[model samples]
Target: MQVSYIVALLALLAVTATAQPFLPGTGFLPLGNLRTTDNGGPYNISLLTVQANEIKGGLAAKQNFTDKDIVHFLTNVECLEGLFDTWGTFGHGFNNNLTLGGPTPIGARKANLSDAVRPFMEEVALNEQGHALFTRQAGSDLPCPPIDFTGGFNKYFGAAYNLTGNDTIESKFGAPFDPFLNDECYLLSVLSLEELGATGNKGLTALLTNPVIANGVAGLATSATAQATVQRMLLWERRNNTVYPFNETVQQVFARISALRDSLDGPQMDDQGLVNTDPRTIAVPDYYVNMIPTDVRGLTFSRTPQQLINILTLGSPDGVGVFFPKGLYGAINKPTGFNVSASGLDSFPSSGAKVASQLSTQQIGTLPGPMLPPNVTGELDLTQSLTGTLDNGTAATRGYTIIPPGMPYFSNASQVAVAYPLQTGSSNASSNGSYAYGGRRFF
Candidate 1:
């Protein structure tokens, strides 16, 4: 079927054969000798399509799963992919620059962007049998990992939101944003892939629809470059630029919405061509493949890193601050939705995370200067930036204040660095990728 399992296989670093055939064992993991048992469980996937349609009589399996067979079955169940990649970042609000978010240098462009490409572009814009398995494999390369699945974004300034100093883009979310990166959701995913390549529509009505491939996703989503590949694929395509390059029918509606969103290998469906959902009847993970590496260098990538520290350190080498001094932009907060509040996980760098806990968690450990001193965010620094104006005028001096626009979380963690947003047993800053801790050990 898979060409007698790829003509009895031979490459892919060669496991030789027995890539199938292991049997007996489920919860503890094993039943694999290539069928006749263990679909991992939950009605063992209708005896795996009734034993692959009694070994191909009724058909279906000329080719099925791939992201290279879930990265070779999670590298043959050895583990260590950790859902998303770049191995979790760490560059908090202040005290940064040791290389900031690591893993580039060898020639940049690999800055991270695989939170499953925005829930596989919101299940190809909300499902319909995931748009017919996103039109039966629309393009290919497959495997849509996003790895984990946190979602929660767009707090305004875009990506992770930032206002640095002289901040512009029409002062964010109000309009303007074309210093490049194009906005409006990258121009509504590039005019919706330029209207699906001037009207091919992936063969009609997009992604084939099955609620967009059972929400794991596999179609639509295309920007297919013409210009700005975010500064030319982050300097020459190291790949992973917030994962857009999509195509093979939007990577099979994001591998069929990561195969109905369920992983750790129960109903696994990544590598695009998904059908998942069985991590004990699904808790979540059919469409989140954000690996985030859209080409990085000295920092300033956006998609949220405190909006690149509010547009390059409060609008820096010198755009000026004290509330945009002339860049002017204010009022939108709507409880964090106008975006750019430092980079979102609530502004990072705060190890303990517990300060009675709540000013909407920008965490706030050392800010004062990156621009927040207009009455310390006393709710109205429309950003004209004389330094946003301070003394106690506050554009963000750090004692933790800003809670006015629509206030919701983070009044604590001690204004930015005190305890537990997952510092858990306590320890942090092993360099970037979120709280890595000095000695670092989240493997």
Candidate 2:
């Protein structure tokens, strides 16, 4: 019976895959009618190799695991996987449409993009399936939530740009939110999603207590993080490789996008037609982008699972409820703890040059975005920004030191969250508590 249902779902997905090109203000018919909030809902996977029959029972049934931790992990994984599959499909469809090499059904002109971009999307699409398989094999039973592509895009871009149509209000740069209609928009979207995927994967790995399962989960996270770095490098190279009207660097572009919220002073859209001609400042707020470029200095940020879910689901109740509907997220039980750090004061390169430029020409390099922080060796200090206490008096400090490969050294101090009552700091003055963990710092 399960086999039959899987077959039927795949067939439906295949049929819907042929739907017309995506247009702003339009909604694509979702495949399964299963409510995202349901417990026994259908898993959104169809590669045949990952048929639902192979899935183990829910992770909460796993041996030697606490019920609360398992439930929380499963809930978060379900939401993350749904978003991954949806993002992959969105990317796949966009790339497939670009291959049409003509005017699309939505009136966007299509041209042959660089060879690098297409294969990247293809790999990302397939990689998402691997993530789905990983979650299922780990005994996650959460249902796959449908992705509202149009709504999701609007929620993201409308907040960032104050316009959502295809070259309607302004014709200078084409559609502000339509990736299919604009190549720059497509690349930017790719960079953003890939980076978010990497962060989400890494953050989730820390909470996986089972060593056996943690190995696989960590591998997936590393892969996602590597892909994100590659996307960042590519974005930088693509911009430098070509001359455009706004021949700006990646940092400049990021700055412009970050400035979009000055009009709103928050992370929601105003929609009052107060946009300016700078092409970056919007009348609304982009909580996601705004959160990305924090004003804090010398430290990088990674969202806890709940924080990320809020961004992915468009602040909740407005989109799929993968993490909501009682999946298990409370103030005390965050999906994962914060753990970020750097080697020492000398760990950051002295010149503040981009990470890519410091590497040997033969060595692979990553951009110095918040996703990958500077990792060097010297006297280290946790920045004031990453440390604090929550409104409820819970210690807010959590992070891992970012360091280069083979260095494997992070002698720094952090203030552990107060919820862990057993924890005692080595000192009360400048040092709190210092610990070391094993892993190659990809930064």
Q: Note the Cα lDDT for every prediction shown.
A: 0.21, 0.33
Candidate 2: worst-modelled 10 consecutive residues by lDDT: 392-401
**What's model 1's lDDT at 221?**
21
Highest TM-score model number: 2
* Candidate 1 lDDT over residue span 262-339, tens digit each: 111112111111111111111112222122211111111111111111221122323223212222111110112112
lDDT of 2 at 187: 55
How much is 73 displaced in model 1, in angstroms? 39
Model 1 ranges with Cα > 4 A deviation: 1-17, 20-176, 179-443
Find the number of clashing residue pairs for candidate 2: 13
User: Candidate 2 residues 329-384, lDDT tens each?
Assistant: 32212322111111111243222111111112122122233533344211021121
Q: What local lDDT does model 2 show for residue 275?
A: 14
Each candidate's root-mean-square deviation in Å? 26.9, 25.8
